[model samples]
Target: MRWFWIFAVGHLLLWTAVPFFTQANGPLDNVEMLNWGHEWQWGYPKHPPLPAWAAEAATYLPGGPVWSTYLLSQVCIVGCFWAAWRLGRETLSPSLALAAVAVLEGSIYYNCTTPEFNNNIMAKACWAMFILFAYYGIARGRMVDWGAAGIFLAAAILSKYDAALLLAATLLFSSLHPRARVCWRTPGPYVLTGVSLLLTAPHLWWLVNNNFATLRYIAARSSTSPSWLSHFEHPAEFLGAQLGAVAVTLILATILLGWRWRFKTVDSSAQFTRTYLAWMVLGPLGLALAYSLITGAHLRSMWGASMFTFLGVLLFAWLEARPDPALIRRTIYASAIVGGIFAAGLGLRNMIGDSLVTAPLRVDYPGQQLASQVEEIWSQHSNKPLENLGGDWWLAANINVYHPDRPSISAEQDHDLPAWTALDAWRTEGGIIVWETATAGDNYETQIKALYPNVEILRPLEFAWTKNQQRPPLRVGMAVVPPLAPIRTAELPTPAQH
Candidate 1:
């Protein structure tokens, strides 16, 4: 209870006076999601549909007009802390648990989490909940415990497709454990898990119906994504991200202490805890390592592993004894690692002081910024607007995922963009075009000028996001159509990810 107050204050402090602005996915993207939820479908082209509902739901909260999805991300931050605390309680003292919570939250990676409408965050929450309840399930063996775990496991799937992997890891570890046969021998938990998986059918059906376009999209993107020469300098990238997601260092210390201290003498339950840590923490990392080497798996969402690491570490701490005193040093070190993150985050925020903003990720749509701008444009053009093909899509029937009802997004992140090609024709017919651009060199802009000698650039928006920099603001530039030469139909450049 006391920690709750502290957590409340901490949560409040992190988001205190924070202005609502475009976050990772941007307002345009979120608005489209809200629209999607209103449509109430099972899935979307890119991923599951839960995030759309979550983002749209966030928009109605206090200060939502400014942008609520980012605000809600703070909620995940707090929830992560609490979950870490509970996890730490399994291994460390209350004070250490609190410290762990703080560390987990402060880690630089966690602090800078940009809210995007995706499974990364949702999966983090589910991972934390899954661990907390799995602890309960193993300890109490209550049917409800497994039921709770089942719910989380299922929700995990909806959050990110990889969640199914987590479930597999859990089952694999459980089955391999000494009591594995007994655990499965019972029909109750199995039934609970079955029902949980059954719930994922809608999403599964959506995937199958679309001929697994989402998977193809992911594969296509991964294969082409730019790879670094060597991230060996920062294996910590994944490590820091995972620790941050859990939001507690003491918890992590605790887990570490237990594993190190009691390696020789462990009980069944202790081993079970260790297994959870192994699967949740290492499972993803192992996959990512393989992906990094073999398949170019974009492990950018590696922070999802933090959901389990924090608990695993805390579980380790709780299992250690203080008399040895060695655990104390480990606890201190862990706390320091976590605390340093918040300090660094604060320092960086102040250092930048909003001097300039940029999104490091090279993207085609300034979707979030575009949302607000498009909304304004939509309002002005209540009379006449051009149909937007959104972007290139593929064989799958793509629905418009843009937020504005006015500029419908063509469900094609992969196929031909009729909208881009038709921009000039639409303008000729008194149609207003709203194009999104990241760099100054946009093919669409070239096309507009080429097709219409008098191609009027209604709005030229320039925005850039660096890897870890403040996203540059959307600068709207309007160009008027000056009579020019006939534009050649040229192939638009492909995204590195695509």
Candidate 2:
């Protein structure tokens, strides 16, 4: 238990502190999430609302520090680790349980990618917690456990739709096992299904009303049409990536087991635990592989985040014939090495990133300064605060997070004006239309000009990358659509005055 907490707390603190110190602001996804979180709905175009809600809650924590999102990501990661430890203790020794969690640190998903506080990170805790609850419910046939499982299952799905794969796998496992099959007659299974659907009903309705925007976004990520060569190419690449991602854990396990371990089918009572572990570990990964093969879809590396929550426990039970103290000592050393290597790599990346001439990282962008300049430029023409922003999601998110008003970012690609704001209100409120003049923003200056033909196009401003001044300056072009009515001084307090 002491070891478990040590790893969990250490993991949380290490990840949170690294990003807080190293990153100028948050990452692109982090700022985007904060933008969505500020005006949360049932769903977004790309993902569900849970991640946004979590990020929003972090920002609302008294002082609204940017580091809070990093902390939120760490909290989710440690929660997953704790869940793994709890499940491990049911079938393995305390030492083995600690190793189960320690393995997670090796994965970039739980370390390097975690501080972004995106949907993948948010879903991880829900995935682990749901698995733990579902295992207890099926094993013990307890109503309370089933209920908890249902709620968390909803949370997992709400965090990201990939959780459906796990749910399907669990159902398939229960159907095949004799003892688990008995759950069909119980109220617990029914309750679990009913609760999940009930919790998901609102998001489902939102999807229907909004024309399944999130699904379209998911489709955009993958190859919808099959290609003859991609069937072989995509899956092979995905498999290779998965192996590389999990190599550290596998290597450590291999070192400890050394081909000496064998699976023991002797214990009947343990069969269910082993089977459950196998299905949970294999299910999501198998689905991803199959999808890649069938559709030639590109499976993202981060999608593997929730798939390996129970991997360490499964490996320990299947292998690790007996505990070797020397092997255990070596495992700790290996884990430490993983942590050190990741820290050094991330530090080096941040440090050297600005010096390169190819392109500056989003972190290198002087978003706050740009926002201030844009706000000043807008205020000179219009009495009202910048009420809305128009551009690509990344640039809009940058302004959304830093601008004094924290205006809503309406992407040009958003088809439904009602989903963001009424077209009339947006036109009446009349805000800044911006596009990146260099590097990014999709070269949308022509589109913005065409959209607001009557609006005055301001002079293009060049902003230097704060961290990398040697790099060419980023040019930003803006246009202001005059507000319908100037805000009276007594009517509402300005953002600066507030």
Candidate 3:
């Protein structure tokens, strides 16, 4: 009881310290995360509903910012660590259990920036719950344990398709283990399967409504590897990252496994062996390697496996082979500090925006800034329809999303939506076309200069970095175009005329 209290207190304290930590006053992430609060469906276009669902919960917290969702994610991760400790203790010594908790929760990688608060979080939570429950039912012979296992397995799969890979590994390891045949005959495993299907029904409905987009996305990612390195780099990088995240414990486990198998005679310890092989040692790393070889696709790292920390318990247990109280105490402090560092890193990412994931942090919309400058120029020059050039769908969408007033030519496609820009056909007069990478807010100077090569550049779009704390580097600019020739009405009909 005292040890459990200590672990719980440690977990709570670590989470409490960094919830408010942010790099800047404002969060700099794209609207994708914020957009999550608006609705809930079985699945989102990009990720499963878990991250967004958690985001919804955070929104209800006191003065909770969008970044709060990331913190909530840690709550789920720490719970998994608790479950792992219990499993370790049941099979090994109490000291190894403590060590297992430390290894699992010590790192910043899993709790900090990873398992982004989306489907990935859902996957982790569900998978961990499944592991915890599976262990419970199998060890204790309870029907409730069976039910929980099924529910979690279903939930994990709903969050990310890759969880199915873990499922396969779990069954394979269970069957290969010494008691594998009897483990399946029990009611516990069956209950878990039934519960999983019940939870999975909603996802099935979503897949139907979304017109099989999820299926396509799943199919695309399921490939193991490709001929070119570029195609394979993503999965390979993901593989290396997972190893690094839990490298300390994994190494210890490998070294200790031989000893445990040889010397340990306890039958209950066999469950721990199964868990080590099924979840930590074999499940994730094995699945990633499989995807690389068979799927021929760039395998992602966090595909339903962020609970690698549990494998760390085996290391702590091995270290416990010495039974030195002083060593254990020191390891505890080190793990706490290490875990705190990782937790803080995650908090920082949420507070400042995930700059590590995104580059430059600035987004472009069809000449959004330039459009405002152009409108000002047109007002000065009599609002006469002007011929424009270099406008694309990317620019068009930005004009619509940001500058609703900046009219431009855009067709219906990826960048073009039902905006006023495309219908405002008055911008077809082709004398001095305005196109610039950057320029000052003005009229026709850019167009006039571009038309006349000898013209001195006066007002170019000025770019400045926005001083947002939560965001990486960001800059915005505006430019002007000058009318070179007299307005040609025969060719430049009024917008109404067009």
Candidate 4:
């Protein structure tokens, strides 16, 4: 327990502080989530509402620094560690349980990629909690435990629909395991089902009202390959990616157990624990791969983010190896080394990325400077606050995060407006449309003209990257849609007049 706390606290602080100081702008997903969260809707076109809600809540904390999102990501990672530790302690000795949690540090999903604070990060924590409670619910037949399990399961779903994989795994295990099947005769399983349904009702209603936009997004994203060969290629790639993701965990386990460890099953008395761990670790992964094989759907490597919380426990339980203190100490040292390497790499990237890479990274985006300039341009045309913005989601969202008014992204580059955005109100209120001038080909101009015939294209503005100033200056193109009723005496000329 002592070692676990030391590792957890160290991990939380190291990860949180590194990104907070190093990143000039929130990553794409983080800012996008913040933009969606500002609307406070039950669902978005691309995903469910929980991650956005979490990101938005983080921004409202004291000082409302951008680092709040970074902190939130660490909190989710630590929560997962805590849940894994607690679950491991149920069957393993305290030191072994601590190792189960510590070994998870090897997985980049828990550290390197977590600073983004997206649906994947939220799902990780919810996945761990749901598994922990679900285990207790079945093993102890406690109604409260069952109810907690349902709540977390609903949260997992709300975080990302991928959580349905976890739910499927739970149901499959319950139906197949003799010990778990006994719960069906009791009210515990019923309570879990009812609680999950009740809590998820609002989102389900939203999905129906919106014509299942999120599901449609998932379908569109998955059907990227139509070639028959994709059926074989996609599943193979997914499996390989999973192996790579867990490579560090395997290496650390090898160090802890040494070459003497044998591939032996646990004793009969602990068979239930071993089986449960196996199901929890493999069920979601196998189901995902099977779906890819059947439908030829392209599986994203990151989608497996929440599927490995029980991996270390499963490995140890399957080997039935007792780890001594010396082995645990060496494993902890290895974990620290892994974490330090990642942290140092990120810090170096932030400090010297300009010389290392040709293209500007997302963290180098000049969000604050861009927002300040956009706000200035908007001030020249209207007295009303910049209540709305239009154009690319990434650019608009970055500005939305830094602009004093925190304008709503009324229109996206894809031209699909969010449900919360009232087109009539946006046009009447008037706002600016912005895009990268370098990427604003003829189509962008044609689209803007078609949407707003009276739009005035502003002079392009150029700004240096936040970190890599040596890179080409970012050139931003802008256009203003005049309000229905003019607020200023000077009437801006239309594109035709120009």
Best by lDDT: 4
Count backbone clashes in candidate 4: 0
TM-score of each: 0.67, 0.90, 0.66, 0.92
lDDT of each: 0.52, 0.77, 0.52, 0.83
Error of 2 at 374 (Å): 2.8
Report the CA-based lDDT of candidate 4 relative to the real structure. 0.83
Off by over 4 Å in 1: 16-40, 90-93, 114-117, 224-279, 287-315, 318-407, 411-413, 416-432, 436-498
Model 3 ranges off by over 4 Å: 12-16, 25-31, 105-108, 114-116, 219-238, 248-280, 304-307, 316-320, 342-498
Candidate RMSDs in Å, in order, are: 7.5, 5.2, 10.1, 3.9
Model 4 spans > 4 angstroms off: 224-228, 263-269, 413-419, 442-456, 485-498
The per-residue C-alpha lDDT of model 2 at residue 228 equals 85
lDDT of 4 at 198: 92
lDDT tens digits by residue: candidate 4, 56-170: 9998787554788898999999989998888788767787777777788888888788888899999999999999999999888899999999999999989999998898888
RMSD of 3: 10.1
Order of all candidates by TM-score, from best down to worst?
4, 2, 1, 3
- In model 2, the number of clashes is 0
lDDT of residue 381 for candidate 3: 55
Decide which is better by lDDT, 2 or 3: 2
Worst 10 residues of 4 by lDDT: 489-498
